[model samples]
Target: MNQDSKNKERHQGRSFTNETLFLKDLVGFQRIKYRYVNVLGMLAGLLIVVQAWALSNLFAGLVSFNTLSFFMLILGLLAWLLRSVLHLIRDLIASEASRNIRFNLRKKLLSELTFLGPKRSVIDEDAALSTRVYEQVDALDDYYSRYKPQTFMVTVVPFIILLTVLPISLITFFIFLLTAPLVIFFMVLVGHKAANANRKQFSVLAMLSNQFMDMNQGLSELRRLSRVKDARERLSSSAKAYQSTSMGVLRLAFLSTATLELFASLSIAMVALYLGLGLLEKLPWQLGSSPVTLTNAFFLLLLAPEFYLPLRQLGQDYHAKQKAEAAASGILQILEASTSDSSTTQVHLKDSETPQTLMLFDSLSLDANKRTRLVSISGHIHEGERIWLSGESGVGKSSLLYILLGFEDSYRGQCLIDGIDIKQADLSQWRSRLAWIPQSPEWINGTIRQNLTLGLSNLDSASIHDALEKSKANIFIKKLPNGLDTKLSELGTGLSGGQMQRLSIARALLSNADVWLLDEPCASLDQETAEAVLETINRVSEQKTLLVVSHDTHPIEWVDKHWKLTKEGLYEVA
Candidate 1:
């Protein structure tokens, strides 16, 4: 894309101020890690000047064949060793702090996503969340552990060096003062532009990730439709876009580094030229007495590079700061979202006590896109009621299911369990009284027993066997070599539609919950499998309050109440 187009895409309502605040909140002011790192860095800075002084004096003594040359050389080496050890220890401490910070930040982000739930959160794209949680948060590692501490040294270390040099040569000190601010001014200017570029780069990365995830998820569909080439082209386009954006960011980072290097080199050269001229007593103009000794000249030259070292380090980590800030933008959006009402009363329901009345009074819900799905809806189901709710695909059947699951609260009215608004009841307590079997049941790469029990420690083998038998899964499961111990692939890859459906039913039965919410239990199954699943539902409904959503209108023996949802409203049907 052209610069203008890229800039427009990047400026899509992003507030740099808000992003800055997000980063500040993430790092915070009272960081104990920062404090420790700063103290060690300042001590290291002090030792740096000491080592420089020793080395300069050693050089002068050696030139004069002085006896103290060896002692000065030893002192320099010792100071150098101590400085190296301190830096190593400081880095270790900073690394540990970075690890802890990343861990805590990821945990906090995940908690926010959980509180937002799938309904409120953007969950369709797996890569979006992964990029924010992993890559974006990781970018902060250098900023916290390296860049930030170096930033402090950039300010304090140079001043300390200036103090040491002032008594030896005021001219060298004045030259240092004049050139240092120019490097900073250029670095700050370049760094500001680099931050914007980095933000754009991270945004592109997220887009690329989402695109790749979509391509992966829909590859089968694309191949079946003979549109794989189209999909590939789209993915390639996204990849190219990301590459271009990344190159732009890298170019800016390189430019900033080069700028800092150029200014630092020039500045050091200027100081060196002045010191050399003064030592030779060859300056065209004189401001003060030339107190330039070989030792003083060497000391000033040695400290010049040290003065610019932190600024160079800061420039190197400048991009890291920008990337972290960009990542913080996404993280903070989730963190700052208004949480759902967590108000809950002491009212609790027994696991096996089938709800006497589950009612929705004037309840409504809007989908994630903020489109009205259900409007002024009202309904009731009594204990032991077998209800089948049907609707056209977009008529809000799933929205209602989400509401009853306590996953969506974009609705306006009330949902009550036994006359108490479920909103007022402890959601965890209320959810425990129910079991849900989605159209696509999830399974881990484990044995059938693990999938069925789902880590419920209290569920014994006898109970599992009984549940499986009731769901008709026991017959097929027993034939396997290890029966319940038979391992399956992710999503139960070896199982047929009928087997997976039966497994879901078995899991629900094992819960022994008062109510069962089955969403399209017979979907995508062959006629025989569908009949078997319907039969399992028929058997389960007799003992529990069953709410099923199915497109198949063919009457079933188990259904005691029937309802249809529409854009107008929800109502009972014949």
Candidate 2:
């Protein structure tokens, strides 16, 4: 690649990372803040202070063990009840935050998918996109919200308590201070390696997930061919891989935890042993009237366990934290993927009768690694200039459709609108002016009108009914009990191939696009039906530019022109 190309790629890669990973980092910090402060925080602070004081006095044996000491200890223990209540509240808050953050992040990721929908054809397939959206995105999101904040809290509050405890007693302070760092270091050495493996597994699982979803989406076709079971087995293997890698990470987490616990226990014992010797040597160094005694030793020992509690929990928290970071890194890689332009640009559609054509594509060609579609394609379409594209299957007709829509940018040649580079033209504006009808219209399970509208609004019933009737889509639609409002399955189970094609066209017509790109609009229809649909296209293209890609079938019996696909490129057919 040239220096300019490499620089552009780098710039885009950086932007994508910034946009995608910021969500997790932002959510993680905010979650910690919300849980750590407020009324609950104040109570935890108060409990720690009183607990510290009680243990100190108990070791001094200033109060009698009979009733006074027991009474004070009981009061301090009860005040510590706030810790339990705080835990419960933290869990409740953490649960909600996790769910919300996950939901929002997933939603954002899905929206970005839509934004990049056109450019996706440059990749091998949309299957990867689907997995990124439905599966991997969710897994990574779960880690972000659930265990992430816990990790932060474990890292934060424990360190704070360590500092607070150090001023009180050097022996107790050294025990936790020395051990916590070891836990983190040990976890990094072992768990970090596992995290790398988990990350690799996630990538393969993502690939397998996309393939499986693709296979499932095509299940009907696979079912006829008896390949459904094969697909299932394939997906099962991917699932197994994901499970084993995840298990490996979890196992490392457990081991790291065990090692941390062992070290903490040993440290506390050493502290206790040191204190026990100090008490035995109490008479050697008497301070005025009182010498340190067994009571004081017992009291310090009692305080020792609780001191280690905060620091020891770090081991467990480290595991959750490492896993979350691993998941976040995966998502971050995708989000940070560099694209040509990440900024939003606006370019509106041009009206047919408008003096200056708003958008134009002169000798446009799209080249991609997808499905061996178009090669060195070049064409021009103006408002009122209807065209048909004929090509062999797997020659990238659909890929070409995506290129015209400004999705794939890997192709050569410039696309101009009104003599301006479409590359710099606002994409959102350009897309707003387009209406597309795929060979198989997506039949989401919804009311007939919803299917017809595709949830895109603002079409009066007259325009909608007219488009449906002309496209031959209204026949089955009107037969339904609710007419346009009839409910349909996800793939329009009750509707035939022809009905699906027409409804999808109606949805596109509703978009009121200035340019229409159709791929095999009449592929599954009979001679008469295909002719009728062509007639509809002819009518629609009168005030709009229409680009059609198909094999033998040509829509618009009187299309303005037809372009035949050649091995080298596109050429106008006489």
Candidate 3:
């Protein structure tokens, strides 16, 4: 079988104890907050018992034509009010705890993605990560706010009611004792199936989310290829599959609830039958007399359903537990995988120290998907030198830039900066001294000013205008109605390809990094615009290092040296 199937089988086979342990570990300090919620639940349970007792006594007094005790009436009302207040407080605490936990988990997930950088895409699809961060994390809400505390309530509340019932009548107590296990039995029996269905539902949801995201992202391409129909059919199939799994989960949930209700109703009926016969003084056995008094019989009858209430609620929350387990599997997969990988050391470069030489030795190679991309390559580039790197498509030119950016760590041999292996240095600190411009620059839906100054601060207006003019983007900015304040849609919509590229160059110029890695920087520009941008780049980077990767030969004219990458290795074309 394939790896995904194997993983699914393993996840399904995981024991309940193991799944609970995983969820508890995620709860972290939030577990302490649950302790307080549980205490409130216990208090609520006691109040429920008190309220039931007082009401039973008052009702028996009325039936017997005795004067009602105003004190018992007052006591019952107070208990009910206090119980409601406790429930409100408990819910508030649990909701806050759930919110905080989700927030912290999302934060950790984001940090992991940031640390993984470009390599994160290799591990999982963006759509899958997005689903985990938003929907799957949300699935834990019911688990924390309801199911977790109900677990304790199911044990404590029922036991308290049983204590109240046992002293009143042994027959009622035995009935409670015998029938309670049946409800729990069927709950567990149906719960196993529900858990499996929930996991399948989560799996289908992630698949559906990924498929939809892919279709949305590539909708333009699909239209161009006249394959939109095919894409739609596939998406429809995934949606249908998701619907099937979701219905299966709901059916099981209803089945579990019905099973619990059937058992609980029968148990309550059995208690009522015993209490009615005893109250009528119609004992079936040769016992001296009916031990059940009117007050006692009424109290036992009142408390019977309350005894099973926690168990019934627990049966309902069992589904939430299943959902949380499924969601936690996805969440823990990302968290645990990040921890298992070998991480870069925390060695930081001195602020006063700048890399003067970059060296590669000992047959540096990069392999991806079991195919060699870079083979036995050795090279060096000194500071303040503009090198033009030329290679055909699929020759690992972009991969080399990825390695220097600390985004690819699977490369063999050493990439050193001024005698320090780049792998050993803190990547954030290392990347701070370098700027990268990819073929297609990324932008958010915001004003042009925000896009330009992203992750930067304390820039004066003069500096911003200077970078804009140097990159020749100021010419277009002047024509726009809002200038730099112009709001662009996602991916810099409303801007031409050349305009977007110029903005990227202008942003890089503002960074003032010592090393600049440009991949097809002028690919989107016309010949005239390309030369203007390249000229600005050459002038600005004269004192810094430049490693420009291009398929075209035009950029070679102004470079200090030229490097060609072939299947064998990288070679200097002097």
Candidate 4:
């Protein structure tokens, strides 16, 4: 095959895989609830047949015998009410199932993100990730609540109607069987195109969302650079692209609905024609007489539309299935990326009464893009040692800290703590023993107390005050209105860089972990502030093992030893 054919084949394969994954998740998440939805659907189908039979009998009694049967009328009304009730029940069950599925899916996505941590950059764009977690997950609501149950109804309800029709008129049954395929044929033909269109629409939506988020986050920079107009124009272009693709999907949906309706109408019309002719004794046959009675004719005519109801509904819901498949593709990619490496051992790292020692035996790290981040280098940090590690820009100084913090594990060689290789140890337990203070600290839009005591319970007032004083953040924090109870904006927007850094240090101090991994902790501070922060860190971390990666020489005097990292290897600076 040529290149175009090969590409088409690959695309088709990917679509199929996405569809399979969606089905697996649907069944796996709420198998019992989904089964109940189908059971209700089947019961409703029987009720539909009963309602049609009663209505047909009621009409036949009035037309043929010139007499009204109140019994038939009551039976028909009761069946109709029961069928409606069944439908309502099915919808309620499906809706609950859909909500539960979305909840579990979001939880899994969040867990994966938490597990990956900094390595979640492999997911490409943060905006795209948010879209998957929110928008894409919401798109599956209709698939689970409507399309899934409808699929079962289309299969079971039509068969029940067929069995009812077979005894009344063979010709109607044959027409039902044969004409059903045409509707399905057109549905499949249109649906293939709709599926591709939905996927494209979702892709464009993700790109547009990512671009909009990026622009929004950097609006100040755009204005300062005099590129606000350019950003606006680019955003407008993406919006137009998304609009075009969305219109394409809507067009395919309309076309599929119309096609199914045309075929369904023609088939129902044919059924009506046959029933009318037989009732008038006009059907072409050797006997030249109607084989179907007046009551049976009424029954067949009343049941004709019911036969295609499921098929029509299925066509309408096919678009939802397509949307869900597209969304599942993105979600599954993230979940799969999280579990791709399950070979890592789960041995829990037990906390030792003695101080812990960290050893690196030629540890190396490769980034998500397969680029060498940390070269083959080996070193050891004894307990209670405050080592200052200096390296040039892009020399993997932060990468080394990430490896020790249990965030980046795509490395060769061993990172051992107390003779236990970290790769083989439980990351959750290992991380619980380490305190990490990144160069750019992050805080949620919550009270300062919440940010400081995150995940650390039972921190009394004295402990909080002690931690803040030790990090030199108490003076600034005390001046703020409401003190620690004062709320801060996202990323600590109300505070200066130095204050945020100090608060981060205080938060780390509150963790009371045995090891401290400080990645350029003072990089954002001035000379005086940096010196103060380093001095505070040295005093507080006197009994803890500290590995501080910085380019400044302020920590050189206080640190036990200074190590310099180069492309060649890690070396001690005498």
Candidate of highest TM-score:
4
Measured by lDDT, the strongest candidate is 3
Candidate 4: where are CA atoms >4 Å away?
Answer: 1-19, 284-287, 339-346, 350-356, 367-370, 392-395, 525-528, 551-557
Model 3 lDDT tens row, 1-574: 4333323432332333466787776677788889899999999999988998899889988989778989899999999999999999999999989999889888877766666566677657878888888898999999988988898999999899888877777788898899988988999999889888988887888888889888887788899999999999999999999999999999999999999999999999988988777766676782556678888888888889899998999999898998888888887766654322243345656553454565454567899779988876888887777889998888888888877887666788988765677677666667888988888787878999998899999988999999998888999999999999999866676788778888888898889887899999877777887787788778777777889999864555889889998898888887
**What is the lDDT for 231 in model 3?**
98
Per-candidate TM-scores read 0.85, 0.80, 0.85, 0.90
At residue 75, give the lDDT of candidate 2: 63
lDDT minimum window of 10 residues, candidate 1: 6-15
lDDT tens digits, residues 1-574, model 4?
A: 4333322322222233555565554556588988998898888888888888888888888887888889889988998898889899999999998999889778867766776676676676878888889998998998989998898999998899999888878999999999998888888889889888988988898899989988987888899999999999999999999999999999999999999999999999998888788777787782468878888888888788888989999999888888888888887777655432344545756556775566555555445466767778888887888898998888789888777766666677887877787666766677888888888776777999999998899899999999999989999988997999999876576788888888988998899887888888878788898887777787888888888998954555878899999888889998
Over the stretch 5-38, how does candidate 2's per-residue lDDT look in tens digits? 4334334324334323554454744555455533
Model 3 scores worst on lDDT over the 10 consecutive residues at 6-15
Q: What shift in Å separates residue 572 of candidate 2 from its native position after superposition?
A: 1.9
Report, for every candidate in turn, its global Cα lDDT versus the true structure: 0.77, 0.64, 0.82, 0.81
lDDT of 4 at 253: 95
Across 327-398, the per-residue lDDT of candidate 1 in tens digits comes to: 777766655442244333456643335456665455555645567777668878888788998878878787
Question: Whole-model lDDT, candidate 1?
Answer: 0.77
Error of 3 at 383 (Å): 2.2
Query: Which of the two, 1 or 2, has more TM-score?
Result: 1
